[model samples]
Target: MLGAVFVGINAWLPLDPLKFCISHTDCKLVILDAERAEKLEPIVDELYAEQKVIGMLVVNAQEGKGQWRRMEIFDKALQNSAAGSPPLEEESVLAEDEALIMFTSGTTGLPKGVLSTQRQFLTNVLNTQVGPRRAILRRGEDLTPPPAGPQKGALIAVPLFHVTGLTSYSMLATMAGMKIVMMRKWIPAEAVKLIRSENVTLAGGVPAMVSDLLDSSLVGHPLEGLFFGGSPASELLASQAQVAFPTARLSQAYGLTETNSVAVGIAGEDYMMRPGSTGLACPVNDMVIVADDGRVASHGEIGEIYLRGPNVMKGYYRDPDATSQVMTTDGWLKTGDVGTMDEEGFLFVKDRIKDIIIRGGENIPSLLVENALYEDARVREAAAVGVPDRRLGELVAAVVSLKAQYGGKVTESSLIESVRKSLPPFAVPVMILIQEKPFELTPSGKIIKSQLRKLAREHWELRQKNIPKSARANL
Candidate 1:
């Protein structure tokens, strides 16, 4: 509904129900499903008392009683309005007018509401269309005509709250007049079923989703393409996906919430050729890697990535200080991700600045170590973090989930040796913990490394206590 309203004069803010109350307190009205309405009943009463919320509009309620009886029924409100009056004249809205306030996924700390304009959202829609053309050019192949008969359908598995799902996929699909099949929740097997049943030609989300789809029983499904962004995907996963889905073009995109989703992307042969790269900048955006001193870094030199484009968000909502810190007066938004760009313009995201592990005074890119661990055929998922050490200041520790087929065959020492082959000795993990289940993933399908770091520390401490006092000294 917010997506539809964006086409008109009314500005809409999409809130994550879990984070909404804590992150925002100025909501004037809340339109929610019955389940959420019940959950927010007490909180809404407090807000109503405080005069923050004017009323609640509940939808999909079979029977209204108690608290719900006082609230307006959303369906009835629409029906009554339609019956009583003629449509009002549309209000004029400028392209510069604010359209949405999307909050960041506060993985690190408090979530900041990102303000975006009508122009920015539409600009992203236009830019996203260029992806297919870029893929064609990069592959040096003519566009493949759709198979005769039905319209091409796209399967949407990611939550609509995300920029990728809303603007990038859903909105883009709406503009294209394509058939959209939305999943209530992301279940890999269910997604595969939808793809086959709905004749879904395009499917994408995070790497984990793609990986699970490829590893599932329906690997031979007729998907035309698969693309993912949001987070870094291991090169090993890319290689496996390409082999598994020969008929589908595998692509990876690189962007952020502030950039409205994709600033760079690679597809087809280009993606397979460059293993860990996030690909070239999108035609609509300009990207530069800046050194700490503020000069543009030479190609292949790691630096902070800065992007400037129409698609960038207007600013942080009502937080000028935070906005000023990230966005330069000149219009460039400083992406806190550390990366390098090749001479050919391909960008390689190294790691998030906060995610880099410092061991014995040497900065180790956690992503590099994690990628090495993924190279092992038995490894299903991997995460690396720095744990405090009495002697080395910090030590590299890794937690990995293994393929069920190789359950007891792969050992901790073997996994450590695999990473040691590709990385320096210091960069090698001092401890490797195997997880029986997959690592807990964020809604966006990224591993919560902070939680893994805490788990790793606890496991290490427990192990030290079990060892003899003399042996603990060597450990």
Candidate 2:
């Protein structure tokens, strides 16, 4: 029900984080599901006293019940709504008018609300359309008639709160008149069923969701395209996806909340050609890799990626200080992702600059170790981090989950040896911990490396305690 026409300025906030944003933004109205109404009732007084909210609109409410009994029920309000109102007329909206306020994932700190203007949103929608348009052009000289019946549907498995689902997929779908099969919550098995039942032609999300779908027993579904964004995906995973969904065009996009959505996309044959790259900059955007010295990095040199385009957000809502930190005076938004661009302009994301592991004054890219571990046939997932070490200042450590078939067969020492073969001595992980469970992921499908680092440190400390004094001294 979070459609483009009805909601002029859409802001999605989870219940737990709702108060902070509402209070900060001085939100005057709230519309929510009736089931969640009770949770907010207790805080309504506090919110009202602070002038954060003035009224509530409950959806899916019983005919008559609860504190919101007098409030306007959203479903009832919509029934015969157009007939009751005067003829709808399009209102003039400026390009600079705020259209959305999306909050960052806050993986490293507090979530910052990003303000996006109508221009940014519309520009992103047009830029994304170029991908499919290019695909159709590449189809080449076909006289075949368009498929009969309704437009093809796309399965939306990601949360609408994230830019990938909302700006990139949902908005684009709306503009193209594509039917959307939205999932209230992501369930791999249910997703497969929807793909077949609804005849979904396009399906995309984080790599984790795609991995789950490929691993599931669903096959021969009518999925024609699969694209993912919001995180880095290994080449190994992309290659595996090609085999699993042979008929589908696989793509990997790169973008962030500050950029509205996708600023770069690679799909179909181009994706196959550049296996690990995040593709070229979108038609409407300009991308540059800047080194630490504030100079533009040459092709093949890793540096912080910067993007400049109309698709870039206006600024952080009510946080000019935070906005100034990330956005350069020249208008480029620093993406904080360390990456390189080949001569062909294909971008390769190495890892986040903050994610690099420093071991004894030597900087080691955690992605390198993770990619090395992924090369092993037995490893299903891997994360590398630096744990405090008395002698080395910080030591490289890895946590991995093996493929079910190789669960007991694969050992921690063996995985470390595998990485050693592919990396330098200093880059090789000193400790390797096998996870019995999967790694925690953000809504965007990125692994929570902070949690993994904490787990690795705990495991290492426990191992040190278990070692004999003589053995510890030798180590």
Candidate 3:
């Protein structure tokens, strides 16, 4: 309401992230509910002293004031300000003014603060509009219209702190005066209920949430526009969702915090035609696939995707050196994503540049391995990660969650054999960790591959530790 530049962070995050968020962004004031306030009590001194925080506004003073003695209660402050205050004077806010500090890349638990301006986010919204409906696909393509009602709502099952929930959904929805129904967490059953009850027409989330929603689907769906971000929607997931809810115009986007959420987008038939493509760039943005040799890539060649546009963020907040590493002098932001571009301009995302596993000088894309795993009937969710190997430097390893019915019965060896049939021997996961539960996901619904990699290493270390010294040498 005050139009103050704020940092949006996960309330469920540990104290280190909380401290980093405050200190890195130089956040002065904090607003928290009862639960978070209590957790923050331990770090109140650090926030106030080293971080130079003025104070905090607690939503539930009764519960929050136990150990965390904040200066003013939220409601009390609201009441006092309203009682005898003069007419509100709006500050001069420009499109260039800093609007938000969003953190990304916490796979290993250290997130970079991406700075964004209001105009940058607005362009991101526009990029979504242009990318999906560009002349390359078809101008004025008649996609499914949103359902009509007194209150047209969108369900945000992801946390508000995430870029998807904030800029991609809430900001756009709010600007259009659309009713926004929020969820504390992704509970597909409760989400189904909310969509039916609220008459939600614009409802979308991550692919995993969509899969869960299908499992818990009730009779009718009011959804007309279903959008996905954080990761690309798999062909199987997209096809299943289309079959389930034929009325909804399915859209998928690929972006990062540095891009303010949208670098490219695809929708309807355009998305379906390209099995795994993240889609084409908006006209306003210049997107190029730069090959390993530093030349602009030809069609169908795999390279690092580079983007430059109004939607691109100003820079990583207060980290000039870090910002310089990603942003080029001529202006293109070197996206660490490795992908191929077709003649039609659609981008096929393969894997991150850093995540490409090199075993004895042979480069293998993790996506190729993961895609092979997905081809198996038993696999539900799969992540192929590189695990440390003394001889090979890194070896292919996979952590997978089986489809509910296949759980406990499916052996790791069977899945490895399945992958081996599709991929080269070097690309096959040497070790597969089969689990019943889904991979622990980021707020944006991306699988935390780093966690699975760590899991594989720990398992290997434990097995080595358990083996007798003589037996280890003999083996």
Which candidate number would show the highest TM-score if scored against the true structure? 3
What lDDT does candidate 2 reach at residue 315? 88
**Residue pairs in steric clash, candidate 1?**
none
What would the per-residue lDDT of candidate 2 be over residues 1-475, giving only the tens digit for each residue? 2222212222333344566766666666777766557656667777778865776788777733544633567766677575597666666677887777876633332456888888997788877765555555566735344677767888887767677888888977787677899998778889988887887888867666777777787655557788866565667778888888888888778888899888987877778777788888888899999998989999999899999999998888888988898998989999878999999889998866567664533445677678779989988888888886643346888888777787567676778888776676777898887865567789999988788887777777877789522111100
| Full-model lDDT, candidate 2 | 0.74
In model 3, the worst 10-residue window by lDDT is 466-475
List the lowest-lDDT window of 10 residues for candidate 1. 5-14
Top candidate on lDDT is 3
State, as a TM-score between 0 and 1, how close model 3 is to the true structure: 0.73
**CA lDDT, every prediction?**
0.73, 0.74, 0.75
Residue lDDT tens for model 3, 1-475: 5678978876755566567887888888888888888778777877787747897888877764444565567888889889989868787888998888888752232567889898987886667665445533464546554566588888877667777778887876776567899998667788888988887887777666776766775424757777766656667778877777787878888887788888788887887777587888877778999999999999999999999988898898888887898999988998888899998889898877656665533445677678789999888888777776533446788788878898678877788888776776667887787878766789999987777777877766665578422111100
Query: What value of lDDT does candidate 3 attain over all alpha carbons?
Result: 0.75
Q: Would you estimate the TM-scores of all the predictions?
A: 0.71, 0.71, 0.73
Model 2: lDDT of residue 275: 78
**Where does candidate 3 clash, by residue pair?**
none
RMSD over all Cα atoms, model 2: 12.3
Instruction: Using TM-score, rank the candidates from best to worst.
Output: 3, 1, 2
Higher-lDDT candidate of 2 and 3 = 3
Q: Count the backbone clashes (under 3 Å) in each candidate.
A: 0, 0, 0
